[model samples]
Target: MSNYIVEMLNIRKEFPGIVANNNVNLQLKKGEIHALLGENGAGKSTLMNVLFGLYQPEKGEIRVKGEVVKISDPNIANRLGIGMVHQHFMLVDTFTVAQNIILGSEPKKKGVFVDLKQAEKEIVELSERYGLRVDPKAKIRDISVGMQQRAEILKTLYRGAEVIILDEPTAVLTPQEIKELIGIMKSLINEGISIILITHKLKEIMEVCDRCTVIRKGEGIGTVNVSETNVDELASLMVGRDIVFTTEKTPAKPKDTILSIKNLEVKDSRQAVMVKGLNLNIQAGEIVGVAGIDGNGQSELIEAITGLRKVESGEILLHNKSITHLSTRKVTEAGVAHIPQDRHKFGLVLEYPIGENMVLQTYYQKPFSNFKVLSFKNIYQYASRLIEDYDVRTPSTRTKARALSGGNQQKAIIAREVDRSPDLLIAAQPTRGLDVGAIENIHKRLIKERDKGRAILLVSFELDEIINVSDRIAVMFDGQIVAEVKPEETNEQELGLLMAGSSKEKAGEL
Candidate 1:
């Protein structure tokens, strides 16, 4: 009596103090692209996890192809032709793409050991069919993020999965890469693969999905055809408000060069230069946005500036003072605040209390310490104030940094770094895992810093965010900056071309 491939009727899920989903219902049509849209903590992710067999619903009945079945574990779900791509990737860094693709279900030779050649052949065939252009022989660590994502998709297809759930698949991709993903999704749909896309981005949902289901406050709102809904309507439905896509930022009145790198060349741990001849200038009261495809020397450039990596040959000046060889602490003292790209690794001590994470950079300052004695009181007070101002939602400051949701974790880091009021603020992927509200707040704060006469160097993979918040933009290719353009004068096409390693004139100068 069902017309869909998968259905969940009256689903209910609960966690200690939270009713994540309440009497929710979702249905996926065969060979169609479906989207689940919601704000943060809206039960979208919870619903997908339940469908993926990560959680068991306390109440509800699930039917697959009109037959009711129980999926107690991921293996059972996989057997039922279901595969999930998590928001954060699960690929091992040291493993090769082919090795990772065949990790769980490796082909056998003579019913013993592994037959990598057979596996590679099938993997390549699957990638070709799905248009997932990935080099199976390449290591996951050395490949581009877009290619890694393709490998993940290929892994799902290689496992003979028919129902695919993609969680924010394009969150870390560039403009060209996003287009490729969309094309792949369409091809998969044409091949009779049913897709369930979970994302908070309205634009992507509108562009790629046929139908969309909106959830709010752990309750199902409604489902609609994508063609019938507008972004404004989707925004209002998601957050129950009329959201503004653009912020009102004043024009930049750039002053003295607060941060400058001249003839910079940075090397990684292996002593090979990754950033070559990177001469850039960020002036006071301006946000110089760096837009590039991932693996275009952005990481090394940020590391060099933040004291995380050594510069082989460069002159870095903070307000005309050389701070290149200074320690991270010394650089912080010299008026440099950095919101690192990897938040958990460099931004916070996940096992430590939230109060401790608030002063991660300045814990050794005078007010936070007395000689060898630490001032827990001052630290706690400062942490509480930041939590209040930054809107970081948590039960208390004593809670572990890991306990906070992704958005709140980002908020904590932004609060800590921006509250320092440094002369130069380096925010690298500051809103990487955040929701719309958090992104809006972070963007406003970045504009606020620029308006307050603080030079901000923002490096992000999100083109929309970069184009919206920045007054000027720089494109990085390989290990150097290839082009610089004003916001009002550039389109995504030009930027995408630049990111793909083409110069302005070569790409038909705009």
Candidate 2:
């Protein structure tokens, strides 16, 4: 008879030397969507892990329907009608959608054999009822990320879960797919299902959630009705600071091309032509943003430009100097600072301390060292200065990179790469996982670099970021640059059409 469906009161969780959650409290009203807002490492995921029975809280109690309950494991939580969809998917790549969904709870017909027909029929009905359409027969590896996410959702729903938790649900979805996800959430709400949305995107929180709980540094700040608070207010509550959201920059002054790509083609690890005839250029003192859905050759384009991928038939010129077929280090030496898309692989060494990560590019040379042995003092000083200037929020330079949050890690990488003073600064999804304040700072820094005669090539999936930070926008579709437009002259609709691979005649006139 209670209005509240579930509540976690004064939760405390710890690991090694860190207290992940410090007295965090959360309450969920039945059939209402609630959002958990925080920075990357502010313990949003840690708190949710407690609810899903992934971690046992050192203190505090979990109550369901006003009755205290002990959830010892995920199996127990599942049996209690609680389900969680993790940000990083947990699906078997080799299995079909139906197999993955009905792995443990498969319908039986011949005692030991799974009833494929019955399972497919029920799955199709469930997907249609909830607006989570999925190709149940398709292999998990062959389906799109959006489809995989829907499949995961179906798996939870199939288990008769009345309470669902979605972590960064729209992180990898396209604009259209995001719309579909919102629709599905609405359907679930109508069906008397309670939902929890965990995300960093304030806009998505504003659009979908009923109420939001702000958390910072493992403590619950407060919860507010979504209608009563704006992004500025929500951001300040989460970060404990009055932060600006937009980048303040004058119009770009056009100049000669600084970085040029001519008919470039790049093959990915799977031997696919990821970038097909990707022709683009970044001019001095201007920012050119590549906007597209994921897996449409943005990664390959950046890799080819930064000398990570082999160019099959094209040219990459840095200030009129051909740099195609060059090594990554050689490309860096040729006046290019590339912040790779995958920060973990190409940005920083997780095992290395902050001091060592700061000098990843130029540690062997420069003021830090003479030739062989690294001067620990110089390294520490350099790293400390960057951490202070960038507001990286690290206690010491001796802290391992892995210990830092995703946003802090990104900031450290940017501090090292952007500070090197390269003529061409290639930033790919630079603020993908950063909070609002960090995003504002990055935008300002990138604009400063552009104004100082450096060319910036930004690739991002977030439309707001692409529009706000870019002077010129290029739309990629099916491994090619389809259309280019001035940001001020374009709207999201036109760009959306171009992203869907509309014809030049249709897009130009429409």
List model 2 lDDT by residue over 1-510, tens digit each: 656889999999987767888888899999999999997678888888899999999999999888899888888889888999987688999999999899889899979888988898899999999988888899999998899999999999999898999988876676778889999999999999999999888988999899999889888898999999998899899888998776789999968899989999889988999888878888999999998878899888888888888899989999899999999999999999988777887999999998799998888876878778778888899999999888886656888998777678889999998998799999988986788878888999999998998999998878778899999998999999888888888877778788888975687688
TM-score quality measure for candidate 2: 0.89
Clashing residue pairs for model 2: none
Query: Highest TM-score among the candidates is held by which one?
Result: 1
Off by over 4 Å in 1: 269-272, 353-355, 366-385, 393-405, 497-510
lDDT of each: 0.87, 0.88
TM-score: model 1 vs. ground truth: 0.91
TM-score of each: 0.91, 0.89
